[model samples]
Target: MSEPSRIAALVVAAGRGARAGAGDPKQYRLVGGESVLGRVLALLGAHEAIDRILVVTHPDDGDFYARTTTALAPAAREKLLAPVQGAATRQGSVAAGLARLADGAAPEIVLVHDAARPFLTPDLVSRAIAAAQAHGAAIPGISVVDTIKRVDETGRVVETPPRATLRAVQTPQAFRFAPLAEAHRTAVAAGRDDFTDDGALMEWAGHPVVVFAGEAGNVKLTHPQDFAATGGPETRMITRLATGFDVHAFTVGDHVWLGGVRIPHTRGVLAHSDGDVVLHALTDALLGALAEGDIGTHFPPSDPQWKSASSDRFLAFAAERVRARGGIIDLLDATILAEAPKVGPHREAMREAIARAADIPVSRVSIKATTTEKLGFTGRGEGIAAQAAATIRLPEEDA
Candidate 1:
């Protein structure tokens, strides 16, 4: 059995927020210590099930956003796929985000959220994702709490609309990838660009849109008063953790490639290729992201195509895949275990090797080594093992 790939979170921050009357956009205005968009992105980015993230913003404002929000760090800023000058409407920004996620393949599920709404909880995100997975289109909507009325142009009440059937929707709407994409396409073809949210477009497409309960606290920062009324817990931040492991049996080779650098060894690890356990582990870590199969699924040992192949190539391929999917690798920590070949002497060189392979800075790549006191195959001096953990920075939102 195989694990399903993760859903992608797409945050739309390109809105002008004309009604807010703030000096900056509503999403960029300071709320607590962070901007509204920062809080929203951080909340979504912290979710373990989310894979890629893409934030759609005005082209000119992208750099400004980096300076204002920690949610998109420098590395994450480099991965942004924002199209300059988003559409005049929110749907236009969504279209741009969908295009970015569709670069390689669209995500299985796309969670569309508003940067103006920063109080969304992890539970809300999880609920939206669950409903989307089950119902194809799921939107968070709260039953109308206020009295309702229908008026004509003459300012006379024509009818009192039923509040029971009315619901106010929120952002972080989740949808099955294909259906949502098609809904946008269909809307655009019909020249209907008035939709304020993706869920509305789905509903117009005649797709069944399941509505789940929503929180009033999950309010969008539209007016100055709304901006001052913040909700939810504080200091919700996003962090990424990665783990990697590799093993190699003893071989008669004279040298081994550890972390992309060829290190001198009396007995090299036996494998189909250069037997670079360090790079193999790093590759696996990258693949582990989004649950995208392992290195074996990509480059099979039984295949003649990978014979004597340099493991660094595998690492580069993984990095490229991440980039092609609108993501960037941020930092990595790798550990090697072996009885004989000392890793301490080559730690600096290994760092350089991995940095080059991952196309990141040497400062972001850390390599260390430790022995198991002659315990397992590696401790018995029969083979070498390497493990790695990679921290990747993806776009703040994705389709």
Candidate 2:
């Protein structure tokens, strides 16, 4: 069998991103839970078509790059190459990345990408590669939705162009590696480094460039407000609230567990798992928010794996479940109903514990304690009960 074509991705991330506000850099800013550039890197590195991935960054951005890269999976990490320092302009940054690739056995096709554009999907990458294989130079572009006009330096309307011929281009722009390298060399030799993207450089070299259909939702994060946008209907942010309640009867034990905290008590609760009513209620609340069923549905008492398992793991699992679906936990509030055990002293500790379990800020967790005024099972000191409410945000998708 003939050797398969090797593909690479060069991510340009050298710009100061001064328009994105005063922050670590636009690419390093957090969107959802992951950084912008980190999202692109993970996506490209995990892609089956991309054999290697290189990043170009400003010299001062080394620390930020190192911190953001730590979140990649082992496979993505393995495909990542040492980043190269870039020049002042975006074109120079891409050229620096290309130079690094030239030092090694160059790939057959290369997809030059912007690290600030974090929403490129694997299917889009596949399309870019296919286009590159069929055509020497290709770039993905969306049809222009707004009207186009040409204006002179004097602010006079020069001409109105037909909107049908206009397109808003996006990356990763695909090209044959050797031709692109030659084009960059020619541009450098001619002192013509003003080309914004590789596609334009190819055009200047007299190479025909084709446009492929690009995703409408694949937007680049430019300003601070762009990071707040969920892109489109499929990823629109929606808020949700759910409530959960659990009751556990007192059993024979030295201490009782509530919200992942151990406290001296006359009796322990009775149930499967750790019997922490607070955690159980919080887990159920999170599941309820996702409409994914209660804790019992996920971890049945019928299963032996959950025998005496810590309730922290259960809460953590629910939190991960939210993040896995591109959601975030806004708040988790739990109230303990118990006459004895006095949950006051351990309230702060409980908040900290819940915060750790959910991987959220400590301030976002709230733990309260009260009694039933000596009326119900909790009032009789026979059992402990907890009611929890969770607030979360998730992408709204059509059924």
Q: Give the total clashing residue pairs for model 1.
A: 7
**Candidate 2 wrong stretches, greater than 4 Å:** 1-5, 231-324, 327-399
Candidate 1 displacement at residue 183 in angstroms = 1.3
Query: Each candidate's lDDT (Cα)?
Result: 0.78, 0.86
lDDT score, candidate 2, position 311: 93
Best of the candidates, lDDT: 2
Give the per-residue lDDT of model 2 (tens digit) for 180-289.
99999899999987999899999999999999999998998887678767442224567899999999889998888888898888787787888999999999999999
Task: Give candidate 1's error at residue 276 in angstroms.
Answer: 29
What lDDT tens digits, residue by residue, belong to model 1 across residues 300-390?
9999999999999999888777655545566778888888788888888888777767766567788888899989887778888888887
Error of 2 at 228 (Å): 2.7
- Quote the positional error of residue 156 for candidate 1 in Å: 1.9
